[model samples]
Target: MATLSNCFQPLKFSPKRHRFNSTSLFTRRCSVSATINQSKLDILLDSVKWDDKGLAVAIAQHVDTGAVLMQGFANRDALASTISSKKATFYSRSRSKLWTKGETSMNYINICDVFLDCDKDSILYLGKPDGPSCHTGSETCYYTSVFDSLHSSQAEGSKLAMTTLQSLEATILQRKAEISESSTAKPSWTRRLLLDNKLLCSKIREEADELCRTLEDSEEAPQTASEMADVLYHAMVLLSVRGVTMEEVLTVLRKRFSRSGIEEKRSRKLEGS
Candidate 1:
């Protein structure tokens, strides 16, 4: 339930001054509390097999969501810097130098833990990114649809795979804002839902009922999945309309992680009473 926003600190930089000369920011290393001992880190670094170009594949994954944020190459210095700074630092193969993620874009990846793959030829960095990982402004490097239809065709016909719920929520919030500002334009389905509370509630109820019905039929697995998607979408729309964020909902869910379902329901009922 932990979000990327909670993990990464926002980077402050002036667009006018540092926009052109952002390379210097990458060169200067920031201080972070080191958890790993120098000796242990040295041994770990030594075990890694750097390729001919003195680089190893570094995969940055979100610690909470288990989503691969981005992948790049890392040298010994890059790995060392990443550990020391508690920020994702990767060796830019194209630039042939060490570059910290979010040095320019201010979308830095806050490091939680770094792991070496079984082969020791690759590294996995568990972290949370401040913003989109890709330069094209997508959440991750993988935005293009390829071979998705092959897998999705087996279930629920063909639907676009939504990997980042946070990103989708952000888009919905933005659309709501745009609709509020626009006078003549037709409001999106999300905006319309936000505008009409009764209609939104009705849609959510309808979707939930459909989802329940879908679950009753074992042969309609794909339809069940589709209905589930509808239920989630409508529920999120309700949250948006109520001025509640997905992150707030996630925070609540995180708090309930230690409690049993019955205990949680009883506790909520007790609080209401």
Candidate 2:
């Protein structure tokens, strides 16, 4: 009778309560990040010297190839939006509104960073283009040069637009692509090298030896440069075959630049371990 009375007593339960909602936490973190970004944008915008029309000349340049892609005018909103979104934006004089590049064409000029000239009147948008940056399907808008057009002695639109190493790598990649399409086409030296891994490696070794010998033999500067160029070209071909980019190699080198050679080697060994 006593146990029955105790059992019949009111039953109480306690449920654990969560202190935070996942969705709300995420929203709060996003809000904080947005606030910090806004503060930075505000500081940057205040530094630019906007003209009477509230516009500044903005020039877009290729981040990789160092080509001047295009030029436009950007108002405060356009500049702010560009920094926020990391897309090249401009204030169209005719449209009288903000227009982002590639909004309609889908060939975006992705901004990597922005620079202000000494005068602070002009802005440089260092970026990479998805495709041809010009409306006429040209790689860059400033393709035609008055000096080059008038002078016949100078090579017209030289292939030197891209840096030597990058240009060589590009050519190697192009040769790789063309090999499959045009099997019957005349086999180039690069094509032969790509087809034969052994030959490519052998050439790289041979060129490297020659490069070293230039110093050993006390060769002239031109001879050393020639040998070094051969070594670089062959090494770049090997890089292309491995599907590695020059930028990737440069990034690793850049990381090592800040550290001593011995320290860098030790770090690599530790990483390997």
Instruction: Provide the TM-score for each candidate, comma-separated.
Output: 0.56, 0.60
Candidate 2 local lDDT, 1-273, one digit each (tens): 001111111111111122322222122211122333677778888888999999999999866567688999999999988877778999999989999988988767877678999988899998766666778666667655455557756635432234555556666777787898887866577777888999989998888888899899999999888887777777887888998777556534544555589987898899999
Query: Alpha-carbon error at 59 in model 1, in Å?
Result: 3.8
Candidate 1's C-alpha runs over 4 A off are 1-47, 63-72, 80-85, 91-108, 115-120, 130-167, 216-219, 243-273
Give me the runs in candidate 2 sitting further than 4 Å from their true place: 1-40, 145-148, 152-160, 169-196, 209-228, 239-273
Per-residue lDDT, model 2, residue 63, is 63
TM-score of 2: 0.60
C-alpha RMSD in Å of predicted model 1 compared with the true structure: 11.1
Candidate 2 lDDT score relative to the true structure = 0.70
Q: Mark the 10 consecutive residues where model 1 has the least summed lDDT.
A: 9-18
